[model samples]
Target: MKASPTRVHHAPARALLAATLLSLSAGCTGASPDAEARPQASCAYVIEYDSRTYLGREETDVPVGESLGSATRPACDDTPGDGDDGEGRALMTAFAVKGVDPAVAIAVAEDPGAYRLVVADTVTELPPELRKVTDGS
Candidate 1:
């Protein structure tokens, strides 16, 4: 039996496709050394710092060691209530953990930083390790 022209072409194409898939799978499993240098933020949550609370979900990556601007008009109150009230203003020196009722999907803070996010009736802190450290230096 003679092989059709399409069959012959497909044989080499199949091999090429298999090789390409294998390479892609391998790359996905383990990142190259260069890619590891810059770690990517997988999740984000709201953070209240320096008398200002920032909605982490709004930003792709949480700003660490940086001051976050007020996301609301007239600024948010510094009373440290359950999240923003929309009209309260906050000073620039106070730092507190304001619990946002809405479960804002957020990744864990890198290091030496922590925040609280409310999911339903439960409040969760990412990277759990942050709790181990004390309030003082």
Candidate 2:
């Protein structure tokens, strides 16, 4: 026996309704609105491939979309203050970069590389003075 058009439509509608109910039920499990909406912290770091040297680092709480141009800020403090691990603070690495825009980090990452900073997302070019560190000199 074949399913009637009405039966098919009803089946699909019921499936959709079930899915919607499941989602609604999940949301009703009781998490605070703020907790659910809050962005988690992330880690950010820079890789240099050229003769770039940083004396220090500093962080500015700029809006996520602001163009982070060539402004040299002091490096973060030796005592860990932000984020996890407490490997000490290092400005850019101090904050949770979870919600940070990629363009912003990309702009910030370019300050050190004369040739390139990150190539293909997996490998970042080593700093020029860091040749000995990579055996690429």
Candidate 3:
């Protein structure tokens, strides 16, 4: 039997369409290969405490279109006081980081020295003040 010209023309188109559909289906099952390694979007906040007292706080948002950036600020309420004078008030520092996780963020905000970097699971000391050195864009 002789193949029709129309059938031959449609054969290639059908094969291309099938291939495209297959690739798209595989992608829908789960995230891309690089998705696991990519950084997630998150916001960070700086919670300042003075001798275990809630002094003040600052929110630092990642710039639009960026995934991560350093955030720092000096204490806003630096009033002179002993804060709490219990038998054990182990927290005295004024600066702490409170990153994205809800529970952890709340704990950090309430307690002293709970710094979290939203991009990773590691915690470190409070970041240095990122002072504004220039006023130009």
Using lDDT as the measure, which candidate wins?
A: 1
The Cα RMSD in angstroms, rounded to one decimal, for candidate 2 relative to the true structure is 13.8
| Candidate 1 clash figure, as a count | 8
Cα error, residue 20 of model 2, in Å, equals 5.0
Q: Per-residue lDDT for 1-137 in model 1, tens only? A: 98876754668889999999999899786366676444454333334442333443222223223323322213433333434353443322212223222232222332245432212213345423322222211
Taken over the whole model, the C-alpha lDDT of each candidate is: 0.36, 0.36, 0.32
Of the pair 1 and 3, which is ahead by TM-score?
Answer: 1
Q: Could you tell me the lDDT of residue 60 within candidate 2?
A: 29
RMSD of each candidate relative to the true structure: 17.7, 13.8, 18.2
TM-score of predicted model 3?
Answer: 0.22
C-alpha lDDT (0 to 100) for residue 8 of candidate 1:
48
TM-score of 1: 0.24
lDDT by residue (tens digit), candidate 3, 16-82: 9999999999876537767545434322233322212121223232211222222233333322233
By TM-score, the candidates rank as 1, 2, 3
Q: TM-score of predicted model 2?
A: 0.23
Provide the TM-score for each candidate, comma-separated.
0.24, 0.23, 0.22
In model 3, residue pairs whose N, Cα or C atoms come closer than 3 Å (at least 3 residues apart or on different chains), thus clashing, are: none
| lDDT (C-alpha) at residue 54 in model 3 | 23
